[model samples]
Target: MQRDYNLIDSNRQQQQSKRGEFLASAAAAIAAAAVAAAATAAVAAAAVAAAAAVAVAQQQQQQQQQQQQHQQQQHQQQQQQQHQQQQHQQQQQQQQQQQQQQQQQQQHQQQQQQHQQQQHQQQQQQQHQQQQQAAAAAATAATAAATPATAAAAAAATAAATAAAAAAAAPVNKASI
Candidate 1:
């Protein structure tokens, strides 16, 4: 009877010990589940924050792009204006050069006309001198003819002097031309 009583007490203690271990395991499982739930909540909050930051950054980048585009357009407009001004200046310079060339041409033509007039005057003077020389020679021949003794000699001398004058005048006219 004593041994049966001891066995019964031992079995009761073993059952109590198993029940304590199971309760401890159940508490640990509950604690683990709570921690997992908190972790999942924190992860979701962080994801939301990151998404907000990305959206703000994208909006700022778009605004910067717009500003840059506006500035580029203004710069291009300025460049176009400068190009037009340069072209206008170039055109004006070309016009000035053309005017200078025309003036030079006109001056050259006037100089040529003046030179021609001077040449004509020279030719007229040379012709007048030749006519005077011829008239003087004729007068000398007439005087010699009245003397009768040297008439032939005077005529020959007058003819030689006239021929010499014509030859000299021919060379002078050719050199002028």
Candidate 2:
């Protein structure tokens, strides 16, 4: 009975040691699970920060693009205004050229009218002088024709009167004989 009691006491001591080892293993597993949960939360926070950075960068790029578009629109409007001003200047030059041409035409017409009037006056003076010369020549020809006929008739009448006077003087001299 003493040997049997010694064997039972040894077995009981061995079982108590196994139970203490199992309790220590359970505690270690819970500690490892808590550490893993903390590491996962840290990784999720890092991912959220990266997404916010990307969104900010995209918004800045959009703002820059809008500013560039507005500047281009202003440049196009200035170019259009310059083109319109150039067209207006060209139209004004064309109008000035047309006015100059009209003035030249009017001057040429006035010169032509003045030349025609001068020629008409010269022709009138020439016709009046010719008429005066023709009248003077006609009067000179009539005077020359009348003078020669009157001188010849007066010579014939004087010769017949002298012949009658000679015949009467010869009869009166017969009484003296």
Candidate 3:
């Protein structure tokens, strides 16, 4: 009986030792799984942070592009305004030059008209003087050739012919006889 009790006690001690070894292996597996989960969470957080940084960089680039476009548009508008102003000024200057030329042309035409009038008046006065001298010579010739009563009639007839000749030869004027 003592031998059997000793064998049973030895078997019970071996089983308890096997159960303690299995429990220790299970605790190590749980600890390893918790470490893996922690590492995965850290990786996910890092990925989210990187994505946020990339988004911010893209937004900044878009804003810079927009600003540059706005500045270029403003510059173009200002240049167009300056160009329009220059064209307007050139047109005004051309108009002024044309007006001045027209005025000068009018003055030149007036001067030419005045010169022609002066020449015409001088020619008329010379013709009048020549007619007067010819009439006086005819009257003297008639007085030498005729008796006193006939000489007066001849002088009167010669004067009438001279007036008719002058009227036919000269241009009509406001002051002409």
lDDT of each: 0.86, 0.70, 0.85
The RMSD (Cα, Å) of candidate 2 is 22.6
RMSD of 3: 4.0
- List the candidates' TM-scores in order: 0.52, 0.55, 0.68
**lDDT per residue as tens, model 3, 121-162:** 788777777776777677667767878779778777777767
Better of 1 and 3 by lDDT: 1
What is the clash count for each candidate, in the order shown? 0, 0, 0
Candidate with the larger lDDT of 1 and 2: 1
Candidate 1 per-residue C-alpha lDDT over 1-177 given as tens digits, one digit per residue, 9 for 90 to 100: 999999999999999999999999999999999999999999999999999999999999999999999999999999999999999999999999999999999999999999998988788677858775776767575766656787777777677667777776766667655
Best by TM-score: 3
lDDT of 1: 0.86
- Tens digit per residue, CA lDDT, model 2, 64-87: 999999999999999999999999
User: Whole-model lDDT, candidate 3?
Assistant: 0.85
